[model samples]
Target: MQPVRPAERRHETVARLLREEILRGTYRPGERLPIERELSRHFDVSRSVIRQALLILDQQGLVRVRSGVGGGPFVAQDTMPAALAAFENTLAVDPSSVAEFAWAKCILEPAINAVAAETISDEQIAALETNVEASRAALERGESAVDHLIDFHSILVNSTRNRFLAIIVELMSRSMDRLTGTAGIRHLDGAHVLEEHEAIMDALRRRDADEVRALSRDHLTGIWREELGTD
Candidate 1:
């Protein structure tokens, strides 16, 4: 294994210390974290390392950074952090693997919809309706609205409230999106995608688990394979 850089080691150590303190209720939410100089001295690391640690904590949704006087990192209200580091690492694979990621999506997304059918809330469905409307507008403007399309699926997956499931789905979708963009599949059939999303939304609203699963899978296949007929 490659040797870890000094800064990397310091940041990890400091982040772990801070993370434990926050989780153990040593630093309650809304309470300001110790200043950087104090943290650096206490941890025997440089201010840069302390800053890096705080940045990691912020990204993990464990702390909020404040600016100006009486401002520093504070424990955030929502402390749960998904394994998104894994998702980003997964998204970094070779471009030739787009077909593989797309295949995985066919299996995964439909399952997410099935779960959403059982666990999704009215508020979540309403958010999906807004996503549908955004997709419609994008198609009307002759755009793929893949971002909106991605958001729609993301919402569906997150509605399951299963972080691991959401992370897996996000990893696949993000990978496929990156690969398709690199392969010039960005201008995919926006109108067709919109229709499929709307249909999926309808099924979800009716809480038809089977239809949601089938339609979600079909949508991925229709767009990923049938639309351009290319990998």
Candidate 2:
């Protein structure tokens, strides 16, 4: 494989560091980040590279860009929904990226769930239970449980108390939204999906790491096979 160019690597590194800081609460919502010139000086890169990094953060909705007087990248106040939407919009332009995202979820989510089983707090578990009940009610009412189901996975990720995992899984869940959307990729049979969610929650309550991992793997791979016809 060809090596990543130095400029590409620099911007990606900058973006990752910035994302970590943002998620760590180093930057408050609406707080302006360091200017491009300042960041370029700190990183010893061109201002253009800093611009590229800012663009990435903007696309991820971690930062919003404004121009002209007093305009720069600032921490987003409500980032989760915007991040998911922005990430999904990016994936929509590249059909192959959807498959790539699926594979990523398969690999990452199970590990994330395993961590959550060990680290999850009582409050997080309660949130998850609430999500499950909401999903069940929606299904019973003949409404789509897709949103709740997506939220269920997101809660599991957040339960890990790992901000990076939360960010990655948030983006993946939105791609899943597209996969289960009206495009007919495959409609998630709510009843069956709810059963799996309930099972996973039970394992989480028991703090069964191995069981959570196994259940999460099965749950995700089941969707992969059903939707993408892949193992």
Candidate 3:
């Protein structure tokens, strides 16, 4: 392969450095970064280069620059919405890819239940119960329970406390929203669904990893087959 050009290499270096520091929690949420002069000096680059780097970070919603006294680039506190927006934008450009994303989720989410069974806590279990209750209420009121459904799955993934799994679940939730939106699948009552979720939750409560894994797989498979007609 040919060597990278100087400008391209510089951009890659800056982006990688910033991304590493962000992931490492060196620059925490709501914490302002040093001024452009300081960053340029530290990186041995010009202010323009630092500005370009910051711009890229800003686009990724990792940082935001404010203009005024005592203003600089601060780490963004709410990255989820930004991440969701980015995913939606990509789906808009390639609508057919949404189905493939949904298929991937059908495989991945049930597998995460095994992880949750091993790692979940009582507090997480309580939180999931709360989500289930909220979902039931939404259904009773004839309101769209899509948000609650997303919340329920989010809680399940978060209960695992695996960042990688959480990221995958987040993407899957967005893809599900897009899929249902296009297919006109409205929110259904949680009366039946809650039992399925409760089975997984109960397995977690009992610390039965195998049962949790099996129940989760069966639940997701049943739902996908019913909704998407996919086996």
Q: Pick the candidate with the highest lDDT.
A: 2
Off by over 4 Å in 1: 1-15, 28-31, 40-86, 96-98, 121-151, 161-179, 182-186, 226-231
For model 2, residues 82-105, the per-residue Cα lDDT tens digits are 767766777778877777778788
lDDT of each: 0.76, 0.82, 0.75
lDDT string, candidate 3, 1-231, tens digits: 122245665655676687788889998999988888877777777788878888888888898899999889999997877787777887778877766666676678878878888899989989988887887788788777666765677788888888988987876676567656622124344566677777777888898989987887777666665666555
RMSD of 3: 4.8
> Model 2: residues >4 Å from true position, as ranges?
1-94, 176-186
Candidates 1 and 3 compared by lDDT, better number: 1
- In model 1, the Cα lDDT at residue 193 comes to 71
For TM-score, candidate 1 versus 2, the one ahead is: 2
Candidate 3 local accuracy as lDDT? 0.75
Determine which window of 10 residues in candidate 3 has minimal summed lDDT: 182-191
Residue 191 local lDDT, model 1:
72
Best by TM-score: 3
In candidate 1, what are the lDDT values of residues 1-231, reduced to their tens digit? 122246657787778878888888998988888888888777777889889989998888788888998898889875433344444455565545556667777888798889999899999999999998988887788766877876887799999999989877765655455445532235666677778889988998889999999998877776778533765
Query: Would you estimate the TM-scores of all the predictions?
Result: 0.60, 0.64, 0.72
Ranking by TM-score: 3, 2, 1
Clash-forming residue pairs, model 3: none
